[model samples]
Target: MNFDLNTEQKMLKDSARNFFSREADKEFIREMENDEKGYSQKMWKKMARLGWMGLLVPEKYNGEEMGFLDMTVLLEEMGYACLPGPFFSTAVLSVITLLESANEKQKKRLLPKIADGSQIITLGWIEESGTYSGKGISAKAELKDDNYIISGTKLFVPDANTADKIIVAARTDNSPEDPDEGISLFVVDLKGDLKGDLKGDTNNKSINIEALKTIRSDKLCEVTFKNTIVPKDNMLGEPGKGWETLNKVLLKAAVAKCAEMSGGAKRVLEMVVEYAKMRHQFGRPIGSFQAIQTGAAC
Candidate 1:
């Protein structure tokens, strides 16, 4: 019945807005867009210090233990400012997936690093098919020597150039009956490069990362895996059940994305209204015209 944000939520929103206005202005954004990593380490550290990087991680891992709605509010502000980097991938994808499926050891070792911003991770699901659902997950993870050998490519991977780890989707089982049956998830160590050719994981095979330019200039990359090896312990969830875990993460991700878009859309409306008020046509402010008022109303 209550639609209003509580006092704490309102304060949180205002704090985020103030931070973005002061630290992520257009000039800073443009500068970062031109930078190699497409993100500022200083800013990332500041976010970690502000307890944002750990918004979703549990208190046991030194996280703030915030709920989904709280993180969604922050995401909205991030979108309004068009915040760059792997905030979504690290905070949402890696954190949520680990929480959903990882065992206690995995949680203890990795979740702390993520919560403190010591490591940046990404999720690679889409391939050349360009699908977000389960069907597009055709990357193979053949079992070999107490480990899995991954061979395939992922397209439109976010911020691969900067991530320390990547939780990749691969097909572990070869059942032709159900397309989604064979799918599984693995956390691949990138060692801080787009070329995920890990020394321990790879059998002298090279992984690849190719940058793709988007209209917004976000860091998108096409990642190729050629006989990449991963330890059996890297498995995120039960074998042949990764989609089940990812499905839940996908739903949360959807909500977070929708909230962010809503904020961005609101920002657009404010910009339009300001332009209408400042720009005069035919000796009157455009905002004074009924047509402009109608546009603003909508």
Candidate 2:
């Protein structure tokens, strides 16, 4: 099989490269690193207009209906520019989970908003243990009448500070033969706007979000839930069987991240080559030196 990018993929790569290079320059990236939200609302809306936000969602939900490979092509450019925001969390993590698990009603209600950039969602899975295994999930969700009262702290949640909703992985069963058997996924509304017949007292008061100090200033947060009530209808997939879906989401996210890192590495290599060519040593360009050439080649 051929490994070269197809014509459409090549065009997408070129467009994304040009867009990032022109919009997310070095100065803009530096500014965002110190900004409170770690991204610009203006630029985000621009991306939505360009249909980047809905690259993976189906056209029925007002999305471009692009596939995963197409998304990676765009993500690589984003990584090269060091673009910061909730794009990965919302587009790659939350959207994939919803597509793989959410029923028709839930998708109709949520996916459109996500596609239009009006809603921002994130996944809250990692705990203080910092492990991705099922045993690492300690947050508990207890079913009470028509609701599930969830209590747990999620560490290093990306963009939780600005998220409208968070899809949390909580343990619904205290004890099971297998650690991954009893976990459930719940959609926690941070803005108090519960949709459909699932309306309840869900609000920001039940949640506490503290932005962590990351070296890259990536808007990561420590989100704590204090008796947060999520409607039963908000749970994605069957109860006590969310680990499978979560695991799938993680795998896809990992691949997407690798693609982004590849782009970043490519940019770094280009910078190194340019520097070597320009910097002079012993009255000659260092890049022309045999040692420098060998090192760069290796």
Candidate 3:
């Protein structure tokens, strides 16, 4: 297969690069890093209008229906700029998960909002123990009549403060004989019933959100749910299929993270090269030295 980017992909790459150069300047990124909301509404709207948010979505669902390669190219640019926003959480996490596991109804109802930037979604999967392997899940969703009465806590939920929806993983079948066989995924209205103070979900009683800081400081938070009620229809896929979904998302997230780190390393190397050229030692530029040249290569 041809690995080269076509004309359209090249245009997007150039356009996104220029956009980042102007809009996501260092100062702007620093400001966003310190803010409670790690993203900008204006930027989000701009991206939405540009159809970047719909890059991975299907055409039938009001998306651009782009492939993963295009998304990865844009992600590299975002990483290079250190763009302060929830693109990964919303696009890579929420949208990807929904596309992978959600039913037709959920996709039809939710994907449009996501594409238009009217709604933000995040995955709520962590607990107080902070184990990402889906362990110690006190969060339970019992089948009552038709709705699932969910009760428990999810901590360190990324971007919970501003998310409109939360894709939650809960224990639907509590069989002590097999703890790992009952997990399920649910798309809940985090902003409505799961909100709480401390930068958490919007509901105070049902779901509480507490904003946390990462090394990058891009609006990561912890959310806790207490006796929250979720509808059974909100469930994604069949019950007890949560682990499979989590594994898929986790792999994608890891790949994105590795791409981000690679971008950072490239930037650092470029910066060092620029500095070495300007800084002269002895009689010539520092870059003339074998050590510096070798270091730059490495």
Q: Which candidate has the top score in TM-score?
A: 2
Query: Taking the tens digit of each residue's C-alpha lDDT, what string does model 2 give over 198-263?
Result: 363446698999999988889999999999988889999998888999889989999999999998
Instruction: Write candidate 3's Cα lDDT for 137-240 as tens digits.
Output: 65888888767778877777878888887888899877745555688998878666433311233343677777876777767677776777766788899898
What overall lDDT, based on C-alpha atoms, would model 1 receive against the true structure? Answer: 0.86
Q: How far does residue 8 in candidate 1 sit from its true spot (Å)?
A: 2.7
lDDT of 3 at 253: 78
Can you give the TM-score per candidate against the true fold? 0.94, 0.96, 0.91
**Residue 38 displacement in candidate 2 (angstroms):** 0.7
Which residue runs does candidate 1 get wrong by more than 4 Å? 192-205
By the TM-score metric, which is better: model 1 or model 3?
Answer: 1
The digit string of per-residue lDDT tens for model 1 on 53-81 reads 89999999999998888998899999899
TM-score of 2: 0.96
